[model samples]
Target chain A: MKAIAVEPGAGDPVVVEKPVPEPAAGEALVRTLRVGVDGTDHEVIRGAHGELPAGSDRLVLGHEAVGVVEDPNGTDLERGEVVAPTVRRPPNGTNEYFERGEPDMAPEGAYLERGIVGAHGFMAEYFTSPAETLVPVPPELAELGFLVEPISITEKALEHAQAARSTVHWEPESAIVLGNGSLGLVTLAMFEEVLDIERTYCLGKRDRPDPSIDLIDDLGGTYIDSRETSVPEIPDAHEPMDLVYEATGYAKHPFDTVEALAPNGVGALVGVPDDWSFEIDGGRLHRELVLHNKALVGTVNSNRGHFEAAVDTLASIPGWVTDDLVTGVYGLDEFERAFERNESVIKTAVEFDTR
Target chain B: MKAIAVEPGAGDPVVVEKPVPEPAAGEALVRTLRVGVDGTDHEVIRGAHGELPAGSDRLVLGHEAVGVVEDPNGTDLERGEVVAPTVRRPPNGTNEYFERGEPDMAPEGAYLERGIVGAHGFMAEYFTSPAETLVPVPPELAELGFLVEPISITEKALEHAQAARSTVHWEPESAIVLGNGSLGLVTLAMFEEVLDIERTYCLGKRDRPDPSIDLIDDLGGTYIDSRETSVPEIPDAHEPMDLVYEATGYAKHPFDTVEALAPNGVGALVGVPDDWSFEIDGGRLHRELVLHNKALVGTVNSNRGHFEAAVDTLASIPGWVTDDLVTGVYGLDEFERAFERNESVIKTAVEFDTR
Candidate 1:
């Protein structure tokens, strides 16, 4: 089996031949179909984060993947069925979170994420996953299944955002996505397909007429170049946003978005900003949160339920949006080119030639 | 009519004579019975916050009052009925928050709070309020009705906290209240009475065996001296708190409380800290909030429904706790004595001779 592997602390990823994994009890051997290359993969390659499996120098690199169950030993899954494997697994020892099927909420350092952390991932010819952690995707979505993982992130965020605003009748009329990355565009698409938001906006730093901006416009949403416009000024230019979906890694957007929220509004933060210090009006921020009943929630990875919902979400999104999003697909041998990001690329996946 | 008044920059409150307020259409004239004096009153007297009504040189100094409806002109309220008047009133102009019956969620500068901001409060011998804003209280809770206003503050915080954690099956087993003042004590009391928390702890900066500590014990909760134990050390001392009710005006407790939360825990912030700058590990804090699924919500004033809930909460409190909480009651002539703070005092109120 050929797999993309990165040596811990090494600068780049390498293609290596490894023995195919064998499924143990309650595990299914999956043949990789497609693995999406995103920012996390780059981080792993750069040795900024992630871990190698115990006693191993090389770590496989992909968390967002689609695969076929090649062998379903001691499990309910059918062979050859398409599935998306969850990225995170319970720690070596059992804790309440994992026992309750909420590994996503596992405490820091308590869980291991395949490729992103201590375990092996699916950027290989074959991988083995626990039966329960594999979410079955419809055959129609097999080619587009790599998106399920990223879409699940938004599903979890929206789920919690709705939960936070449950105390009052929160019929939000407008929403803004704070980044025009693939995640942001997908979030905007989800709002259009699912939520009852009458007006939507996407904020990005790119100059006018980019793919994301065009996609947002095509989705009947407005685009604001954040470089040209400040975030706090948006609500006054338009209306106070009822919900702000922050996917930009710039930490300031979350704070600035809070200032623009309508009374009782919520901000769903999905980006993990780099460590940067900025002066914040803590008193004013606290006052707004307290007096206006605003809430901001930060969400990361998704759980099985979110993954299932993501499958449904992907199926419901306008075909054109999904088609426009997967702008590039490269053969497994062209993994380096696949990892290269560009202005026109929404998502680029490495397709496997597994047999 | 006599009223407790404070000149804008004056450091003391004095009793002054005022005209009896007449009930207008959709208004009720309430003869004050008792008004609870909390920290806000002191802040108002110090001219640190609060505003004088329209052209008046002084601001009436009470927001938590229990009174009898002396006149119910053009309203459903009946004369002689016991009521607890809510402090906040709709701003001169209308906004969705007030029109939608959620003045507590009103944006800054949108609502005027009686006694605290632009409107006169229930500190006078008689005060007028819109009939709709006066929450009806049963005769049994008349003497203790002033406690409703403060209790309502906790109700709103818990309301938002509960709403924020609604995404999961959040049956919290342990809780810690971050202050031992009247609000903190009331918060501990509410958790004991309302939530199914197995263990409760109240943190205060006081010697052991004090009234607040003894009162917490009487309520079947533990009291920790925060001077001896830091916030982050709490989980290791006992367990990571599932819920933290932070009522201390200390600016750092909320952030520290976030560090102490268990996965999926919610921190309800009810205190408004003074302007103070402190370095926070923003990256670590962001990671905790994102990876642990923790939520922190800031809640200030409460609306009529919260007041109604507060009434029920006060009535359900163990009689001894309520009796001991209001440590003193001073006549209008001795108003200065009620404003004095000491270690032994829990809560003090100004009683009016309405009869």
Candidate 2:
């Protein structure tokens, strides 16, 4: 098997040939399919994320991938069936909050190796995982199956906003979303369908050399070039946002909308802002926030409930995710190109040449 | 009529003669039985807090008070009835969230001429207020009804915690409360009766400074002095806290036991730390607090349900607040003495006769 491998301490991961893994007693061997590149992967690769353990060499660094079980795994999985397991190993799979029921607490996240992290990842020809780790995907989910990781994030965040439980029939109070990237767009899509939000403000790098406005607009989202617009000065109707989603991963901090929250509004943090340590005025948060009864919540991943909601949502998405957002797709050998596209382009996919 | 009034941003208030208030339609003329002074009064005098319109002075500073309806001038009240309202006198008597069950957003709070806050407060001989502002205190509740305001705060904090809704039953969990002031001991009392926490650590002012220890002992709480023992360390079997109430008002500061929270723990905050600015590594809070599904909550004058619960608890208090916590009584004319005793007292009652 060919896998993407990174040397310990730093440096670009190399895609190299490795032996395909066999299923252990409680493990499931998965044939790689679609692998999604996120901020976690880039950090792990650059050694900024403290990914590899003491003895590990080149590490595997992919967690968001959809694959099929190749081993007749022991618990809850069948060979040759599509699944999207959150963890790379048994106990520590996923992040700390990704429990099965509370999938948000899923531990043992996969980001160490395609052929490296601690175990091999799906950025390779094949990867091995535990039996219970898989989340089965249907043929209807083929194009967007790899997105379960990010989509589940949106689902989990909406759980905090209760975006899905809106009762004004179809109209939610207006929403302003900062960061028009994949997560932002997906979040906007949620409000678009699940709630009756009259308008949405997607604030992101609209002036990027290669912009992603079409994706936002395609999802019926209105884009705001944060570079161009004064976010905080967007008038009271927009100033005091009904909801604000911070999704810019480069420490996309919530500077504008936190205090700007409508008296009893809600702010959901979905992006994992990397390498930033700042002070939050708990008093001001209490005074201005709890005083007005505003809330700031950090919601990580979703539970099985998120996956189920995403599945139902994905079923109704315009073009159902096939029309756009899946910019490019390549085979497992092109792992580097996949990451390169996520950087140079935005939202790329790694398709497995399963046949 | 007499009122204790604080000039704008001054340190203490002085009693001043004022005309008896004429009740407007939908209003009531209530004769206060007693008024309670609190840290909120401190905020008002020092100008740190007040629900005043811009550039206003001659503000009264107390809000926690009890009285009897002298005349049901226009709406919903009868003559000679004891009552305590949840402190509101909204301009138009409504605000965004309060009409929707949020009292914290009330526009004009009860802090005016009655000698306390926004609207006339009850630190005076007679306080004019609205009929609906009254919360009926079953006559049996009179002797201790003045304590309702602080109890309302405790009620709110617990209600915020119950939103998690997991630990409704008395789980075998311990709590370490920071500070042994009124809020602290009140919280201890709350845990003993409402939360039923197994072990409670009330870290007080290096020594059992006030009657908080007695209150805690009365409520069966363990007292700790951070100065005496190394709070950072604990024997493993000594259960980590399930809930921590920070009543000392330290803003943006982390508690020593913050890192000691078990998975799925919560830290409820009522303290208002003075410093307005500070910083923290968001990742650490996520990894340390949130990722493990730990919650840090900011609660204030509680939601209505907590208010109801708190009243019940206060009513169930063994003595009618006379024997222990309530240390002295003074007239509104002795404003300075009342303020002095409020600083050095557990709780004090304001006698209206001598004013």
Write one digit per residue (lDDT tens) for candidate 1, span B1-355: 9999889676588888999988888899999999999988888888878888889888888999999998998699999999998888877767887888888877778889999999887888999999989999998888888999999999888989998987777888999999899989988888887675789999998886689889999889988878788999998887899998888767777668778888888888877766666566666666667767777777779988899999888888888888878898898878788899998899999999546
What digit string (tens of lDDT, one per residue) describes model 2 on residues A1-355? Answer: 7777676456787777778877778778887777877666777776765455447576766667888777756767877787776643323445433333454543224223332245545677677765555677786675577788677777767665543112111123767777766667666777776665777777776454444676666667677766666555654435466677767643424434556555445566665554467766645554454344444555555555566666677666667444466667776555567767343365776676556
Scoring each candidate complex against the real one, what DockQ results? 0.50, 0.27
A7-54 in candidate 1: lDDT tens per residue? 856667889999998887899999899999887788788777777788
User: Which lDDT tens digits does candidate 2 get at residues B1-355?
Assistant: 8777787575578777788888888778878777777777777777776655336467755677777888888677888777776664445445554555555533224112233344657777677776656766766766567777778887766655545424222143778777766667666776776667778777765454546677767778877755665444532535567676767775542333445555455566676655365565555544443344444545556444545666788876667333667676677656576666333477666767421
TM-score of each: 0.92, 0.81
Per-residue lDDT, model 1, residue B310, is 93
How many pairs collide in each candidate, listed in order? 0, 56
